[model samples]
Target: MINIEWKQPELILLDQTKLPTDIHYIRCTDWRQVAEAIKMLRVRGAPAIGVAAGYGLILAATEATQSNHPFSEQLSQFYEFAEELKETRPTAINLAWAVDRVLTLVKASISDNAITNGEALINLITKEAEEIHREDIALNHAMAKAGATLFEGQSNIRMLTHCNAGALATGGLGTALGVIRELHANGQLERVYADETRPLLQGARLTALELHEDGIPVTLQTDNMAAYAMQQGLIDAIIVGADRITTKGDVANKIGTYGLAVLAKHHNIPFYVAAPYSTFDFTLQDGKDIPIEMRMAEEVWNFHGIQTAPSDIGILNPAFDVTPHELVTAIITEQGVLKPDYEASIAELQSKVQK
Candidate 1:
């Protein structure tokens, strides 16, 4: 196993929007700046966003103390800031989870009266931020092991994946891509087929880059090629990550995921969703309840400042699409591999963890 450390502080992030060329990292200081960076996708990926959100709260708390704000005032400001940060991206539940955790930490510090110095409050929040990062790394390992079981005894697997679901998406390994990585590490993987994932092209850019760098066998194909690949027996399984999984086991992921699920159904291949438990949303009963984030039309009309379509043409680009639980063969989380009966399995897992 390779020991992975967080990127250098100076290299904050490699601006995913400008990949393949112009690899640049933007430096950040203070929490609001980090939140803005995250909103702009200067720093992104589900796990990375969560990690950054933790740091953002720390930065806000530190700034409040420096300004000599009263504890009551700081608390009010912190909640408002946290809410704003949570709204930056709607699909990824980890962003909200991270912010809420940090808010709890801030509240505890103020109520505990264990630290008399205001500076100590800042230090405490920073510690929690680091813990969030550390915990994510541990969770990734657990999720990978549990998810890998889906491929057990299945050799020469030709797995097809969508978007950037590898280490770039999670803390260290990944969700869907992590299982593929585990298979490759064990020499069970034959090849990984990546969907170009239109518009954003996370698969062609990030997924392709990470797999190639790790010496994993991979090929990039357009979103439409998935069905053809499966038809030709080029795909043995379909593995992908999720932005959110409802209580009913319906999954909301990259915009094209629903289509892929339909294709998987026709091909009679097993479709698996790999994600941490944090991605689960018990509040949503089914896919219909998951909020679909509609992005700006400029994303579709413009390609890197070049006009891809006419300015007068209207476009509706949704950040994510939902896949019904019926289309999913299994849902992999740190707790274990769950069948489509998520309501029962998730409730069971939550009860155990809460205990």
Candidate 2:
């Protein structure tokens, strides 16, 4: 379930757009191709996108190094690749976080004169990219463990989730879904309800597929049915993955996630957001500052080239929406779950990391 694979000078991505039926891989030999895959949703999910972007930088550096360009020129090309990859998806903070991390490492290496040769620079970049990938996997596992603790002493926990945050979405198990997997492993999970996320249907096509393959009991419901499901007491809790979590604990996730959080609040169901620390955007004080990506109108008006709505009609297709901090019961990360007073809690966790 490795969605993004780096085989040195080449990157392979699972074609997410054609899932649940056709399994295909898109091979990218250059950074531009990787950027295109991100834009086209070939490699999606916040963590997955970040991992892909890291490898994309490696491809760019490899190409520049193979050209025998000056170290400064190669460095310039790395920045260019970073800019292009960063622009692929606006909602996911992990994309920028990962790119900046690798770029900063390269800059530090140059400043310290630790990388004098092109090959050495390429090797360093590749190693860093691999580290990002490996760390994402480990973080997902840690997040699973931390999140599962919330369900301690509870059995047959029925969880509802939005979008697809499974192995296909990360380098390892997943985020929110990883928690569900842990619950299932412990025999504490009763069933999982997946929302058929509109326009893309990642939950229906990807999430359901992943859970089914893993032999986890799952039920598929349309996005609008969540409220009814909650009313029926079919849902014990709501857990989802985040694209961006601001310093104040506000979250931006798939477009329907905000609505789900609202419903969870009204229904008195706990809402949890699971993600790696990289998904946190410390600079953004609130979710309002997190930019939302608006996708093409055809995604709503048309399905697989078949018109579902009148052509030329107005459509507002935002790829993500923000949920206020108060609506979130907890924010689960690899470190641990952060409770209320999130500004202080998040800062404390980040400081621990810095130390």
TM-scores, all candidates, are 0.93, 0.98
Global lDDT of each candidate: 0.79, 0.91
Q: What is the lDDT of residue 249 in candidate 2?
A: 94
Mind sharing the TM-score for model 1? 0.93
Task: Return model 2's CA RMSD, one decimal.
Answer: 1.0
Q: lDDT score, residue 232, model 2?
A: 96
Leading candidate by lDDT = 2
RMSD (Å) per prediction? 2.5, 1.0
Per-residue accuracy of model 2 over 143-212 as CA lDDT, tens digit each? 9999999999999899999998889888889999999999999999999999999989999999999999
Reference-based TM-score, model 2: 0.98
Question: In model 1, what lDDT does residue 257 have?
Answer: 90
Off by over 4 Å in 2: none
- Which model scores highest in TM-score? 2
Positional deviation of residue 307's Cα in model 1 after best superposition, in angstroms:
1.2
Q: Report the C-alpha lDDT of model 1 over 1-355, residue by residue, as the tens digit.
A: 1212233232154577777565766655556667777776666666778877877776676666665667667667767777887888887878887888777766776689755555776677677778888887787888888877877787898999998877777667888888888888888899999999988788997889889989998999999888889989999999999888887889989889999899999989999998887787766777888788888888888878899899887698888899998999998888889994778887876676557
